[model samples]
Target chain A: MQMDERKRKILRAIVQDYIATAEPVGSRTIARKFDLGVSPATIRNEMADLEELGFIEQPYTSAGRIPSDAGYRYFVDCLMGAQTLSDEDKEIIERESTKKICEIQEVVSQTSRLLSELTSLTSLVLGPQKGKSAFGKMHFLPYQPGQVIMVIVKENGVVENHIVDVGDNLTAEDLQKVADVFNQKMKGYSLSQVKRSMLHEIYSELSRQRHLIDNALEMLDAILDGSEEDEPIYLGGTLNMLNQPEFRDLDKVKSLFKVFEENEPLKKLLLPRQEGLNVTIGGENTLKEFRDCSVISATYKVNGKTIGAVGVLGPTRMDYGKVIAIVDFMTKSLTEVLARGKPRGYK
Target chain B: MQMDERKRKILRAIVQDYIATAEPVGSRTIARKFDLGVSPATIRNEMADLEELGFIEQPYTSAGRIPSDAGYRYFVDCLMGAQTLSDEDKEIIERESTKKICEIQEVVSQTSRLLSELTSLTSLVLGPQKGKSAFGKMHFLPYQPGQVIMVIVKENGVVENHIVDVGDNLTAEDLQKVADVFNQKMKGYSLSQVKRSMLHEIYSELSRQRHLIDNALEMLDAILDGSEEDEPIYLGGTLNMLNQPEFRDLDKVKSLFKVFEENEPLKKLLLPRQEGLNVTIGGENTLKEFRDCSVISATYKVNGKTIGAVGVLGPTRMDYGKVIAIVDFMTKSLTEVLARGKPRGYK
Candidate 1:
């Protein structure tokens, strides 16, 4: 467990070489490619020691050794150099994030695509969480003879529409009057706050005056009663997995895709637990499907509150330093975009 | 090419056998599997004649013959029988379509997933088109001190929001006044109708008294000016393509995925040219990228007007009769769901 200086250098060399070539690293290749002053015999001895310490393993009897999960973790935590992104990648992030995207969903969707394009890895973006967004306003429009469409807007610019049957009796003017009352009372309250405390007060007042409007009020309560189900998980660049040498086996590709399609397990994988950048390398992830993969995720904030996360999924042999740098830059860019009132067109 | 009853049977047997097993069909295997009265020698002579007529081809010099694109076309048009859905497949369609979906996008998205799941191929669903939809209503909510979020709803239940800067001088009531007037005039008119004839009448009238509201009108014009960009082509089960033997080559998989990732070509391929079920087999597709694939697509309706399409994409060896039947059933289900107005909650 004690990683001496020579062992750390050997582990870093193996990991970097494996990531670049996708082939196991041998002592001769390391001595030729990298200028480590040590001879091939010394490097070979150091590799054996690292393998004995459980940092690397030989995939085949005659083949060179490759870094294990623990090795990747150590390189990321200790031996990796600071990542400096290429000018092209920096420009891509700037061009994509500043495009004329109007909706929060568009912002998140584009960010997801940008992450994958930049890193050549599958990206998943959890859109801004709805629980903390306060109620901005509400409007009811007469849709059909017996139906009215209720459009609710959140302070963070999330919009949802629910159809309610209010019968043929209520005209557009009448529904507008009811919507005005609800808007006045519930204006700056978060959805949870309105669902808990404001529902009783508003319902009692409306029921005492106009009993007929009680149906619409009850429908509003029922709409927000359950948690927001429409919060989407945007997935991009799944085909990129096919390009990875690690996922050349079809079974691995299928298992990874099943997690994406099922969504529940992927949501668990992406749920941000803390404030800053987090990396879970192979074997560190709780889900067995992801044991061969590495995830680099960071939560984005709105008004300094963590609202959602953006992350990348790739083979454990991924370029950890570069992917981490891209994900970190993306998280900061997304937070800035969402904090601005309008997603774009301010120029 | 004419007056060939025996040749028809031989070609039908070859197509069916090859579709079942992705391998080329040999005369011995055909004679053993099918109840053809002809000897293997006789079948081989008939296969040679069918190949001479451009129906089938041998992949390698030593391999048996496989159905060419022309053979598949002939089988679909002449030899294929009426498809009957299995009890399990019918139940899956019934269960999935009747789930508690609340949005048209959800309906199309679920249908795409069901198509791919049932057929073991990739599915694409184009959400309801916005051109033929009439304007249902519009609302303006104060987003920040100088901004407003414009939520526009179509009669077909599609909703869109655009944030516009209307200056801090206008109150919520003033914006409402402008919205009410516009909504009153534009209600029940198709988006094209409003864009063409009504723009002059409304914009001239609004600019006469309050030129401040003109910015909002211009935003609406710019929003609907270009064709709908958000009609959203939902693609599902791309990983299923990898399961096919034809896509085992990573280069082929990469090329196919590039077509799916880029929207314009796929959009062109899915555009419904006529009513009822449409099938384009290999070599029939105009795009070279899909030359090795077959597409079965059908347009869905709302209130008797064609609005959108659903389709499946698979290798050239796809089961034609069954996929056609399933796509037909889904088209009817989607049309019915959209015609009912509410996507779900009616039960």
Candidate 2:
């Protein structure tokens, strides 16, 4: 299983050639095209060893070999060279990152579209985790006669609103008083940091307004204590999968489409587990639907906190060296753009 | 050519048979399947007349004939029978309509998914029009040292927020005073109804706070006067296109995918024009990409005001009776569910 220099060189050649041409690589083709400084016979012996070790597989007895999942894993891990992004791609990233974005959703969506277009693969950009954002402000605005729109603004500038029925008895002033008390207690704490004890303490302190604002308080408590909602998945270039030769079979296309429709499984696959870039090749994926695909994802940070991730999905023979570079570069660009926070033309 | 009862019956049989089975309908097959009293030779003569009239076309020289776009239109307009919803589909629609939907977005998205699952064709649901909703209330909440979140809530319960920078010099009290002025002036006026003269009057009245709130006012003016922003398209079952026999060719799939990816053309095709259900078949579509397809769309209303639409897209040989019935029924169900507006468990 140890990959010496010669074996590594040959394996890299096969994977790269297959990725570029979507054609299996024979020892003769490799020796002719890759300039390995070795004869076709010697390369043939090495190819047989690679196949024996499970790095490559032949689709037909007579056909040449293509990379197995393990082969791609090894190629991505040990042999892939540093990839410099094309100037055209770099320009697109710069232009999108520098655009006057009014909302974080726009940034995430633009990034997803840019990733898909550049790499010609399906892209998924997970929106920032609202649960991780520190409380900035809260407002209770009177809506129809019996309803109120409760707005929550997070430190990272994400906003969420829910309607609560308070009946016609309570005036706008009454709701304002409750908002003041809630804001005083919850400000600067992330949703996860606002524990049950803290909520109980706040309830006891607001005993006088308790009955009138009970429903609002309960709703607030539920939101703070609830399991994290799924981050909105900004899917882009879903049809790009059609361009890949691996998805020519309609069943594969259907399975992939079903995964996109369900969304939870794909989100689970892309959820950032740790800092930095990661690649899951073929069988490395736990979901059966994605077992035949490769995913390259990188967590993006804002003020040193891992807030979201952008990922690319394609066949296992994906252009790893290029897609990985684009994804890695995108995360950095997004981080810088978000951290700047001062959109051009904003007074 | 006038369509006599016999011609109509024969054309209906041909269209229905072709729809049920993807194969072209030979005169002999039609004679065997249908209880037509006429002989095969008589049916063949009538089919030839239908072809001469451009209602049907033979795919190959000797193969049976299939309905042309004109034939489908004729079937839909004159020959198709009223279709009743299957009990299973009715149950699904009723269940979705009655479910606890906290937001209009949830209802629209759920309906799109339901449409796709029921018919096994791609579905598109256009969300409610924000421009049509009357103004309800507006709030300006203080955020970071130099920023404010401006929230506009329409009468229909849609909420939109934008961040405006007002600098640290303006206090929360200043924002409240500005909001009071805006609420008093803009309440009950739809965005379309707020005239330029009315804005001029407000600007003159807020002359004292003009410099401090100039950017916020300009943003409001821009939003009020700008063309409508694209309503979010809730697309579902895009991969369902592969299930159609006509889309087996990769080039056709790619063209359909490209249309979905671009969105503007598709949205234009689906935008509700009139009050009732409408169907565009095959060559009738203005877009070349959709010329080989059919789209059935119906606008759903709330309180008798048309606001949104739901549509089904499939090949030219789509089950017109079934899809038209579903789309028409869905619009009615959506209209009723939306008008109720009172979600259960809202306390």
Candidate 3:
């Protein structure tokens, strides 16, 4: 059931037209608009063959034809051309991506939002890989009677905070000494490097401080080693999903809503272990619920190292030509800004 | 268009049965299952009348009846009985809710996951309301040369960190003195309470200790007063939406996914600032895309004060009977655990 060149052209034309108008496409419409130098009869014959091959379907006896799931699959893989972004679109993405690079979280969050706004589709951006960050410094400050605040700063400038118990009584000088020791020894080391041996070394050194902050030191070790829960997942422009007609069915709406509710599947779907712009079409996503949808994703980098993934989700009928171009340009723009590694100076 | 008591009972029976089975309800089947003490013919006549009034529909001439949108509306508003949770369900919720209350973010995230698992439906939870938590303390710790980490602890035991710049050269002693003054003056006061007059009072006093750190106080004030953004919205079980029959249509699926992407709309949807459980059925929600859906939500509290909202989303065919009971009970359980403040001293 292989399609000939003319049949491929007809299939692409139908899918393209259906995506634009969201209406069933007819042979007469394609014959008149596309100027393929074929008569209505010949075009109709090709459409009949296309339908026989499962690429198109007629809603009823009198209605026009629409692309079946198989039709969209072929269009995305073989027929669709790479859409070129307008100069204005490029400038918009460049401005937005470069606007905030100092804060990695901000860069990812803003990039998702900007991509969603530019494409008018749902966008997702994963945060920087925590495992990759080298420890730059850590500071412990006492707050109240029993609570202590711990801030971990990575070499890439990402800062995270955790609160741990410091028992009932501790002097300000004791906390300061603990902070100084941590900064001197742990700086420039990754979290993985701060293993049990490193903890034993720090514990023996703290014994010389008369047990003043021994509890705080143990708590610091726990905070650094145990805080390996998954990094935050950034989602943006969910409202954009509402604009697509695929969500009109009540059941389809609910199932898709469910996918957006739990983010673990999405995080796993966009895992940065993979390379290039990965497109998971219907039945390809790991999650059974997203079987009918498609995910278009790519990894973003900073200084030539992959940091996280940025992706967009829509129905299998997703306009791949446009979304792919936007995602491709956005990944490049994001890499350029993040590589600079400087906060946008305030006006 | 008005129905007698018997017709009402029959409509309720049909809707409830149809909702559970997702099958057309036949008169004979209803007669046998419900023991309505009426003949199948009598039930058939009433069902015919009901269909004329748009309470039910027949997919084909020979098929049994299914509840129409009007029938579902009626069941939700007037006929549906209050749902009671089993002891096992209550215990599971209580056990999960009481695990760790100090981590407010973790509580919200886990609660959303638990609710989704319990209901087998999508769940959404908003973060703690900023205005609800009074600021208790602020501390500063220096990291590297230009970076200073600011720790703000709320009265509810939530800790937040922000990294700010304090020029290029400041020692540990200077930062400690600056922190001491800030804690002494601003302890037990909210961020809003730190006004210009109060900032000036702290600055003039700090000038007496270290002029180098005093010069950095203005930037610190700006960072403290202006850096807070809206809290993040917690959503879970979005992938579950794909499991429902309602979202099978791509347009509806896209619309619902779009809602999860935009923070502002989601914040507005979840934060109506209303009291008690808020149930917005189809067409009642402010967002047009949600007109075909229903949201069952309730506000959770701490120490008898309203803090945030947790909700579940589904199609108009959503099990209002079950979700309403679950949301109400979970909110109560969450509030009780949070009010206790600390974990049980089992250790």
lDDT of 2 by residue, B100-155 (tens): 67767778889999999889999988877655555656788766677777887755
**In terms of DockQ, which candidate is strongest?**
2
- B1-347 in candidate 3: lDDT tens per residue? 68899999999889778767767899998999998999999999999999999888898997999877677777777888787887787899988865755566667788999888888777889866655445556677655577777676666565666666666666677777777777787776655666888878877887654554443444444434443455667877777777777667666666677677677777766765589987776666789877767788888776566777889987766777888889999988877766676431100
- Give the worst 10-residue stretch by lDDT in candidate 2 chain B: B338-347
Clashing residue pairs found in predicted model 1: none
Clashes of 2: 0
TM-score of chain A of each: 0.88, 0.87, 0.83
lDDT of 1 at B218: 62
Model 1 Cα lDDT, one tens digit per residue, A1-347: 57788788788889999999999999999999988899999999888889888889999886999999988988999999897778889888988777765666678778888899899999989876665556667877555677766777656565666667675666677677677777898887755575645676666655543543565555545445344655568998888988998887767777777788776777777885667898888888899989989889999887777778899999999999999999988988887777664454111
Q: Best candidate per lDDT, number?
A: 2
Between candidates 2 and 3, the one scoring higher on lDDT is 2
* CAPRI tier for the interface of model 2: medium
| DockQ of predictions, in order shown | 0.43, 0.61, 0.36
Segments in model 2 whose C-alpha atoms lie over 4 Å from true places: A1-4, A133-137, A154-157, A184-227, A342-347, B100-102, B132-137, B155-157, B184-212, B221-227, B342-347
Worst 10 residues of 1 chain A by lDDT: A338-347
Ordering by lDDT = 2, 1, 3
